[model samples]
Target: MDPFKQMGDWKKNMDQFFGDNFWDEFEGIIKPNIPQINLYQTEHELFCVLNIPGLHDLEKIDIYADMATLELRGVIDLEFGGGQVIKEEILQGAFERQISLPFPVRSDKITATYRNGLVYIRLHRLISETSNKRRVNVRLLEDE
Candidate 1:
């Protein structure tokens, strides 16, 4: 049996098993999730803290909040100068992350602030009437 023929067969089998875009798919799994977040909740409010370094332009970031979700979309560009990278570990790219709130939140009452390479978000809880018990008035019907 020829060793060159065996090597070619092994390569073909790997390509078939992983597909042509195996590196791209593997990179996606290996890359860390950007802007790591931590969430806290109180009786009437929710707080979120995100670790997002190298955010020069605030305009590049967009934050959206609905009743039960919070979405963050932004770009983290850390390209200081063009040079050969020895070892790359920091994640710098465009990212979108959606988080589910513990409870309903008021979208109109959300506030966000950025400081010390961290983004802080404050969300007020939406008190829905359905979640609270209400006493309904009872009326007697008149018979003819």
Candidate 2:
């Protein structure tokens, strides 16, 4: 006699036949979490190149490093007004990516330079050996 009651009854039957956990597991896989990263390691140091364009200010970039981990945070603006976006593929928003370093580096000595569209960062490897006291005898001057 009631339209609302009929729809509710149909939903219950459909869910029971399909199993109650159907939608539960379906939603989890449908929308999943993904981490963004691109990293490589060489014998000397580890290199990480992140694709960041339209970042104007140097203060926008934040880089921090510890003994093993390095953190990078920045924002990529997607504000291009007055034009309709027909197709959008690139990510544009606040992004924070953390990468693990292959070897430890001095945080104070780390240098970063941005050019073109990529951010280049150089991390110096920690020095294990330094010049110490070692005396070598040299022969007196001989004129030829």
Candidate 3:
């Protein structure tokens, strides 16, 4: 029995069972019935884009990140209803999406903005650390 050949066959079997959308399936188990998000990465930084339409205010969007995880939460309003009900394909109501980042991100230097119908956020990969020092003098008081 060849060990390398056996391992290769096992890998193919697992991939076939999971399919190409294994990540999507894994995310669904954790967060059921939530809006999907697309994440991209580069050598310098990470790019995240979410599909949220009918957003009235940009302030409504909230983004938070730690050393290893980046979380996104927001609400989207879908106005539907006229006189007749024919077909509905778009997802309505509020949605919240949370994604795990590959590397550590600088939370303070994070920038985000919402334009048109999509929310864009730019996260810096290599964060420069800054340090500041301050000195204070204290005087002793005498009691009479």
Candidate 4:
């Protein structure tokens, strides 16, 4: 009846066949939503926090905000010196993530900062006379 239920059953079978961490081992290749994020909003503002560790240079990260979208691009590189890895879990690679905002935001009124391995972004909601509704003037075009 449920197609997703069969998919879940297949996943369980695969996990049993390959081991519990089979999928996790391919995360770097699969590139699964790296640098997890949390978003919160208020009446006039939006706050977003991203979990990204091992950042040495801040210039590697770029944050962009538009009327209805927020995008982040960055790279996380951690070197462990020429050694064998027993178990790896942390994600480290170049990543780009775009998120849709709940409402329109002022592109010029956004600020972002990184502290303690967390990236914090603050955005102000666009509140203007034309924010909700605006009149568009139509002009007739004449063929040359």
Candidate 5:
């Protein structure tokens, strides 16, 4: 029996069983449902854009910002109006997740805005390490 031929047959069988969307299904299982976000950094601030459609009642959303972390707690609900769900793709229900910022920010100076079904959060940088630089003098010890 040829080992290469057996391996080829096994590969064909596995491909047929998993089909095209196998990887997509696997990714969904691993990550579950979480709101997608886009983060951008600039010299003065860090911006985060969160995709949250069909989410009514802005008051239900809670966002907490810190120098190193950003916390979000929110609920998303969509009305289908008395019908069995044949297919549902959007994430719905309550979600609580903390996002870590790449650079330290001034929590007190952070600002946020909501427009066109998107939440934009701006975290002002807190003396980013790139800007605040100081040189220390090195002292040599005398030999005994």
Candidate 6:
């Protein structure tokens, strides 16, 4: 009696009993995927663009910035009709994502805005490389 053969038999029975749509329904009710995000940086700033469709109330969104990180928290509500669910792929509920900033940023100077179902965040850099430290030389002379 092979263990693999027994496991395969059990797997076929489980698949036939649950069917393919069972897992889809289970996922739809259990966990939702995280929102997609796009990040980029410039010489003096950092930007994060997130694709967050179906968000209506701006007050539900929260943005927090720090020297090396940014966090976005919000919830998306999705309502469906009361009937037999044929197919469902969209996710609805609370979502939070943390992003690590490329360099130190001005937390107080960060700004965010939402438009066309997307959220745009701008983070200003803390310092520019305009000046650098210079080494000083010392000279010794015979006492006179």
Query: Could you estimate the TM-score for every candidate?
Result: 0.69, 0.58, 0.59, 0.68, 0.65, 0.61
TM-score of 1: 0.69
Tens digits of lDDT, candidate 3, 1-144 = 866567557767877998756645655553354444677899868888777888887777777887657776777666655676444445555666567888888777777777878778888785556656556789899998
The lDDT for every candidate, in the order shown, is 0.84, 0.69, 0.70, 0.85, 0.78, 0.77
lDDT of 6 by residue, 31-138 (tens): 544566788999989998877777888898888887788888898665556897444456556888677888889877888889987899888998856777888898
Name the lDDT of candidate 3: 0.70
Q: Model 1 Cα displacement at 52 (Å)?
A: 1.4
Candidates ranked, most accurate by TM-score first:
1, 4, 5, 6, 3, 2
How would you encode candidate 2's per-residue C-alpha lDDT over 44-129 as one tens digit per residue? 67666667777788798888888768888888774687777555456576766667787887777777777765777777776667
Candidate 5 Cα misplacement greater than 4 A, ranges: 1-29, 128-144
Pairs clashing within candidate 1: none
lDDT of 5 by residue, 41-84 (tens): 98888889988777667887888987789899988777667877
Model 2 has a clash total of 0
TM-score winner, 1 or 2: 1
Q: Deviation in angstroms for 141 in model 2?
A: 62
Candidate 4 C-alpha lDDT tens digits along 22-141:
897666465468778999999999999998898889998988887889988998778566787545568778888799999999987888888999999999998876565668999999
Candidate with more favorable, higher TM-score: 3 or 6: 6
Q: Whole-model lDDT for model 4 versus the true structure?
A: 0.85
lDDT of 6: 0.77
Q: Which candidate is the best by lDDT?
A: 4
Per-model tally of clashing residue pairs:
0, 0, 0, 0, 0, 0
Off by over 4 Å in 6: 1-33, 81-85, 128-144
